[model samples]
Target: MVFWITLDPLSDLSRPPGDLSSGDLLNQVLYVALYCLTMAKLIDLGWRGARPLLHPAYLLLLAWFAVSAVLGVNPGTSVRRLVLCAMVMSIVGVLPILPRTQRDLELWLGTAAMIVVVLCYLAVLLVPALSVHQADAPREAGLAGDWRGIYDHKSTAGPMMIVFLFIGAFLAGQGRHLFGGVLFVLSLVFLLFTGTKQPTALMPVILLVSRLALRTRSRLLFLALCLGALALYNLMTVGSAVIPSVSDIVAKLISDPTFTNRTGIWNFAIDRFLERPLTGYGFMGFWSTDAVLQSDPLGQLAWTAEATDSHNSYLDLALTTGFPGLCLALWVVVLMPLLDFMRARLDPTKRGLALLFFRIWLFCIFVAALETVFFLRDSAVWVSFLIAIFGLRYLACYPVRP
Candidate 1:
């Protein structure tokens, strides 16, 4: 949690010649702790008890990632990424084993989230130089050049606050009314100051839909809604290219037709992906590579040299691991767990857990369209999604009746 909040803070802290970033170092330590705990649990449970704890689809997904990394363009970097991937999955795998009850899990997570939120507030109040974006710094649309509130960029802060908003909602539902309400309001204020347009606009609608989904308690309904939304998004994306009116209207609405110049980045990424359709350039390969920089796909665009990611998670994954990796990811990271969540009986006692996971999954799906989040190393969003996926699986298999 501390690591999540302090994402690579620019401190005068000294380190060895070849040390990892503070965030990565902390993540590795957490991974080691989780590994030890998981191994201990496995030993105590024995093979029969542990067998059910393993999710076959997740294991298969891990295997595919390993294979892709081994065969990837940058073998050294891919191998390192593969290690991080395994560590992340291991952390998620042990979640069910670590928590004694749903309440216990909720309490632990809620408390931790609250602590992070409080720390963010303190950083913003005490150290504005480090926490807020500078006037001359790049600003996103709708921010009016205000504070980012404890994150390096407005982009990062916006998404983090969004996560905290839902976490606050969950805490409130769990009867931590005052604490949760305060956190939610503070998160909203911070989000507003960051000036993030999409997430800020979408929050209310997402919350409303989540409430409806929980009330319906029908997995098919949720799935149908998701499919419909995805279809609509695709249509808009396609229409932007084929229909001038659609493009004009979107441009008028957002005040930037190219989605703040993301289209150029996406186009470059697409071309790069086509070059290596079967196996991509490798994990974190394309953006920083000399070949990509030399090609200069963006031409005279302002952000050409500054862009780090494709901005779309799907595109990023395709660029990193190609079609095979993308397909495996869709199946294991998304489809399988979605199917499981839908099929699992949502008893009264499990409804809260079900709804929490459902909300997180839905949020992840929506956010992926605009952000490069899937399988990102040391990312809060990715970690949150893994928790949701594994937590739902645990609840489904165990079927705790309160």
Candidate 2:
């Protein structure tokens, strides 16, 4: 599921790293079809005794969608977002009432983590390898020398793996240390090999925040040691004159104003949003119509670059649905952590789930500041479902003592 969701965005499908087989496209469509069918089946079965779409979160999400439908610049895009939201909500709706004990909670989370691992592994197998030119740039090989595997962008892979890594790390803390440690290590290695700088920068910030939020006994000490070790690791890998020094690499990263010209796109989006402060461009409105995109700052900076959505999600939302839309979405995101903290007191088992979701959500938002996040499916969607599930599930599991 993650593979299909990510492949389009990450692959260099422009030139395509490998052969362009019709079979490949067929397989991709089939994948989506199967996933949708499975979700539908699950919802169908659950409907016999499942909760209705009357939940508050469902209402809020639906209201937001209706607004987008009426006001959205691109009804098609707005509709797509709405459908995705509905699918996710359905998943949340079917979750069995909250687990009665800490052990039950662990089982649920463990199942999810295992599924993530399996999906990522399958992605590694399904996508074909493609060789990219390295004449002026780094001649890096993708999943396989030429295979990008499931994802198109090298950057997305890192964050995707980071989420898994945190999940694995939490599992390790729960006493499945050996298995968890291995999973964590694999995820970390995958992130490093991707060579994407954002995840490299974002992961530590999340890790630090998670430790503090979890209020672990040795959090401060752990953070200091980890930071020191990370510095040393960078010194070894990127700093050696024999190799690329961290300083040299970081300087190069900073010098690239575009970060692929995302910054310019963000600025353009902001300006566009300012034009429609109350209900900006209708959903998916900004990119479609010729009037939608007034200028291409990205095109001016680079020889040939595709400027799709604004690089930033916040800007994208404002551009699509206006300030109200953006604010509502942001509210959904901001409330996750506080909700997690509250749930943690009721169910200690939920602590791990909360920590994992919190970390992923935090990084998603951090990445969103620089990158438009919704074009591809991501952790944000999954975390949102988890938030709704546990929020309702916990309430059902443990009624108020009073």
Candidate 3:
């Protein structure tokens, strides 16, 4: 778990360029070291409580990484990501082992909630305060809007918090008594302040779905009314002269067109794929030297300077690691959660929690359609979520409450 917490330093690019003459190699070494340490600790622990690590998803992820390494254009880069994945897999592996009781679950959740509180504050208030730019198209996004965050980008952090929001909302719903309400409220506020589109859209949808899922008779009707009211609010605000900011943002959304030109990038990447159609330009290698090989006919794209990721995880996987890596990555994400769905339903009480977590995870996947390539990055947080689902699955199989 400690490895999981700090494994990110391996991927951290914020280190001063002069401090580390060579950035990439240092990051690679750090990742490898972290992986070794975590594996050694897990082995020393006798694998007594290490169940999740042995799961199908964990094994598949490792295998995918191995394949990626063998096929990777930059074996070193692939290796670093592989090592980071191993650390995260270890954390998930340890989840079922460490917190075996409700008290433990509550304690862990409380600690996580506290961390979110601090992180959210940093993200919202402190980061915004540190902002130096104000223009819509400034030289840099500034602290106020890094687009990416302390980790990778808002794309990652935003979806990550949505997962936490689901967890908090679930616990709060499960009768956490007094503290639950506070957690739920904080989760909502944090979700809003994050300002990512998916959370903004899905939060209300989750609340509505949760109310229905809980079987609160008539509550569904109330939700419908509330939704109507929300529609009315949007309708009234859409053109009202009183709210210029809202109008400006809406106009921007409308005018920007086709999701900020994601279609163009997708088309360009696909055409490049058609060129090689088989191996492509070696994993993560194209964007560096051979990006021109990509098909960006529109010339309205950024294939060089700001073209680090493809936004779509599947597309990025295909482009970087080819079809084989793409298949494995998708399988690990989709199959694991779907498998847990049954275990979740086995116990009606925990079904909602299971569903909420699943929804949040899927929401990330959905948002990935237009944002970051999460699997390529240090996905410790998402991996934690997968571990949590595994834990709940075990709880379903071996009942404790009854």
The whole-model lDDT of each prediction reads 0.68, 0.54, 0.53
* Candidate 1 displacement at residue 173 in angstroms: 2.1
TM-scores, one per candidate = 0.85, 0.67, 0.70
lDDT per residue (tens digit) for residues 1-402 in model 1: 633555465331122122221125665676677667777776776545445446676676666666666776656666676777677666566665566676777777777777777766787788766566554334333343455655556776787788788878877887889977887888888888777887787788778876776666666787777667855664454335445787787777666777666666777777778887777777655654554655575566555455667888877888878887787777766676666566553577776677777677777767777778788765777777777777777766776634
lDDT of 3 by residue, 1-402 (tens): 332233442222332223111246755576567657756776876665455446675576567556656565556655555555565555455555455565567657656765655555554455543221223333334434443333334444556556656666666666765566666666556555555675567556656654453453453463454345434433323222234665566557665433554555666666565665444445454554334533444555554445655655566667766676666666666545545544565566566556665555545554555654445434545564555556545554555442
**Candidate 2, superposed: residue stretches over 4 Å from native:** 1-58, 92-149, 216-260, 288-305, 374-402
Worst 10 residues of 2 by lDDT: 130-139
Error of 3 at 325 (Å): 2.2
Candidate 2 residue-wise lDDT, 8-37, digit = tens: 433444352442111245544544564576
State the displacement of the C-alpha of residue 210, model 2, in Å, after optimal TM-score superposition.
1.4
Candidate 3 vs. truth: CA RMSD? Answer: 8.2
Q: Which stretches of candidate 3 lie above 4 Å from their native place?
A: 1-45, 55-61, 122-152, 206-257, 276-302, 348-353, 379-381, 388-402
C-alpha lDDT of residue 95 in model 1: 61
TM-score of 3: 0.70
- Between prediction 2 and prediction 3, the one with superior lDDT is 2
